[model samples]
Target: MTRTPETPLPSLKERRRLREAQSLSQADVAAAVGVTRATVRSWENGRTTPRGTTRDAYARLLTGAEEVTPHQENPAPALVGAATGPVQTSPDRAEPTPEPPSETSPASELAPTLEPALGPEPEPGPDAELEPLSPSLTPDQAFDALYAFCAPALVRQTYLLTGRRELARESVERAFQLAWHRWPEVAMDRDPAGWVRATAYEFALSPWHRLRPRHRNPEPPPAAPADRALLDVLLQLPPVYRRTLLLYDGVGLNLPETAAETEASTPAAANRLLHAREAVATRLPELAEPKELHRRLAEVASAERLRPAKPTTVRWGGEQRARHWTRAAIAFTVVLIGATTLTLRTAPDHYEPPLAPGATVHGVPPRVAPGPLSAEELALRAKLKGEIASGPERLVPEAG
Candidate 1:
């Protein structure tokens, strides 16, 4: 009387539990195998038999078993039937059970079935209207999306730097405009909105633009606004000090990046940053109250939210581009003309008629003899000629 071990069968509930343990829903598994959830549910409930490829997929997914066609009958006895046979344990008398083929491994079957669903999803059309106020961004979208994304932080930063709502808004808008011109390139950059904010900060600090004749008035200076008094003091500091303060305190750039951006050594940038901090601390006591400063910042940021988006009708199309080229061409022509004219005016003139022969010496022409010299003149000429002939001989020592 030998005992035979029972072959255990997995229950439907157990199969479902296994699927759940693998982090797959019935619908997900169905989708993977191009079947309906209802079909998957029926399989899991054991309500219907899965056939053909579906059966093969199920066997592979659930138990790592090869798909056996309905026509192909197994010669070996079923495990359930084998359990009824008498147990025998002698090595030479042992019956060999055929193992399932390795091609039907669970991982291999499931992996192939699951990969198609995880590939890159197609993007929505360009003209598709975005969800209202959501950041549903596209590659070719306008710069307005970027502006909306960083508006809050930019407003806060601008207020912190300028302490004036109007100036802050202007500065931020100008920076955004500059970025918009290069939007195609900038939008692809990581943290593009942050780059714009940094550009805005630099723009606001530029002395040529910020303190230019266009920004100034001929009238007498008015009393400094209380909220912006500290900002005024900060502006009065040297440009290097201002940049160091803004980079360190306002934007939180580290010393090395700041030094690289400002073209200063790390130690020099650090010193400038330290001096700026000290200057701000020293000036804070004489400027606006802390509460007032905070209130101004909040007010400016609130105002920025209320500011309406500009009309997008302004076009920089081919016509304008052509016009720019035309202007450049005209400018180049003018420069060429001016350069040629200046060269002609400054160049020396070397043309002169050859001098006439027998030109007057000092305003008197040479006296022409009216006739041949008289005898007296001839004798004088002869005596002068004789002196000229004997002069060299007389100069030589006589016989010595």
Candidate 2:
């Protein structure tokens, strides 16, 4: 029988360690296990699991991995260019190899340079992975590199998501600012570009944008009819679906990464993607094909003159924002402490019940005689008393 959950298997991280330690890539594991490479990747990422027969195969491979001998300097296998030759993965960083598209997906049609827009990386020695942490580039220099590399494409992608040129620039700048604020974590992340990308996406799609007076109304449509129609159609989609489409079709992410970043189940992400495509296809049937859609998206994004701020400016803005928030927090803390101290110092040593509030006496007023009456009022009162004493019908002739 296949091992159940009760069976003590190595933790997921350990399993991955065992595989990588054996100088095997996910592709190699999938090849040996008779599964697709994505499946192997998902399993390692804790996205999915192995089934009965496959589980046994995986368990056997990794279980015996500990006993496997290593080459004097066994290098990790690189997945891309499999037929090229013996490729060694640099130990310093975990760069993902581009996977072949299985079908007509818009993201697949995008040139790798279109979305992340990274330059071709060199195959450095085993110590190359640690290069990011090396003293060669300071924080500012490294940040500038990442920003310069990613900002243009990321701004375009954000434009596709938000449909506003200015908002896109603002979002990308804010994301970079946040990255600078948390430079250590962002720099150490496996994919710093992705970190900034996710942040920009979140900022671009925030619902709070709707409340802003300037953003309360939709931005002007594109000058070209086709661009305008496409932009309108995209803006009509729900924020989540629109975001998913932008990430998958516009930004060229695979479904798994798209789902992970969007915080939705894979199936849910797929459904959103399908609905978004259908909506777009319904409006612009000519762009029904995935490749065409992707091309159109890139064109629309590029057509806009969404210029991002310089890296130095962005860094300075982030510094200022951080300082502002820091001072605000300190001021608030000081106010709170002062208020508490004042209360304690001036407060009575013991509890004193508050005086009962004065209440209106709901009773008749004490009888009192009037001081004086006006002459007119007095005559009118006397006349009224005479009529009461003698009825008008029984009045006698005036005899005295």
Candidate 3:
């Protein structure tokens, strides 16, 4: 829609530029717009669009800031260095580079570069809330619009995948939380909804949820027999086939797009979709027709009141979660550092040989004193003196 004289919303890029020009955090604009910071971030990202009062407020904010930031464009280059280099390399490059150390968020950071499985992304649901038709939307508006548009349908989609209400809701929220975390990468994504969709699908179908106690037992199935049967069939299908069928038949994504979201080769996706449809048809022959199956999928999903949290709630939860993890990480790091320091201080610096235990010695002679001289000692001496003359003969006789 063309911007009217009354509400002149800026282009997506311009909204971000203006916010940056004004040296504002998303929180600042969010407060001014009466929306959450995440909504403002969404607007800057073009995932949603501001509408009605929010749109007008956003327009005025941008319009007014236009006057305030006129000087930024002129001085930004000199002060922060030219955008030609820094914007390309350092400034944005420095945006957590969440990829390098953890290489985690970059699945999205790197996601933009990765092509969807070999096909055009299927047209997303009516871009009504998505505002694909509204070019003048700010990123914040775009994000809010995208969330409001995609979130409900996505929740229903997740329910179909998981057959559980809470898990479905949690999965969708987690996906959006992730989307918000990597808003920059997601905002720049060719299909922000697809990005969030893939993330939600991956999370909903995650094998780990089974381990949680709450999800250990399956939720009660739909009350209607038909709904229950359809859900049972859907749940019975392999997660891959279930996702493929739901994406292609249920969500109305094209073959390639379904394959892309499922992260399978186009042929593999087709195979899964075929198998899924076959299984459903086998279970409920009435659902043999693709349209019928799609209808049933939506009907069964909607049968349950699988309400997702508000976008604002998801956004706040994401921020709180990120903060929680960050604090945990800092605490862990401090503990680790303290432990290392303690080890260094208390560790022995040099080796010292241990002393051996003392033992007794053996095979030694005992000291003895001679008794008093015998009485014969004087007689022997007198006799020997008298016998001195006979000593030679006595010695010779002794030898004989």
lDDT pick, better of 1 and 3? 3
Sliding window of 10 residues with minimal summed lDDT for model 1: 110-119
In the range 1-400, model 2's lDDT, one tens digit per residue, is 8846622457788988888778776656766766655567677777666656667678888877323343232233222222222323222212234344445434344322232221122112211122355558899999998887788888888887888888999999999999999999999775677789899999988889989999977788899999899999998999899998877666656555677789887657767877888899899999777667877887787678777889999999999999999999999999999999999999889888765789565676886977788999999998877864656755765665
The reply for model 3, stretches above 4 Å from the true place, is 1-140, 353-400
**Using TM-score as the measure, which candidate wins?**
2
Each prediction's TM-score against the native? 0.40, 0.69, 0.57
lDDT of each: 0.50, 0.72, 0.65
lDDT per residue for candidate 1 within 1-400, as digits (tens), equals 9965333436877877767666555555565555544456556756444555555566566653432221221122111111122223222211222233244332111101111111122111111112233346653355655565555456555655654455556677767665666766666543465567667777766656546665564322214454345556666778777766554444434344455457675557657865665576577753122223333334333433334234142123323555788999999999999999999999977877887999855976888869776889999888767764655766876563
The backbone clash count of each candidate, in order, is 0, 3, 18
> In model 2, which residue pairs have backbone atoms overlapping below 3 Å?
92-129, 92-130, 93-129
Model 3 TM-score, 2 decimals: 0.57
Model 1, position 142: C-alpha lDDT score? 51
Per-residue lDDT for 43 in model 3? 69
Which candidate order results from sorting by TM-score in descending order?
Answer: 2, 3, 1
Residue-wise C-alpha lDDT for candidate 3, range 111-220, written one tens digit per residue: 11111121123233321123233567765666676787677778777888888888888888999899888877887665788889899988888788778888888788
Q: Name the regions of candidate 2 deviating beyond 4 angstroms.
A: 1-7, 12-34, 51-135, 352-400
Cα RMSD, model 1:
25.1
- In model 2, the worst 10-residue window by lDDT is 119-128
How far does residue 226 in candidate 1 sit from its true spot (Å)? 5.1
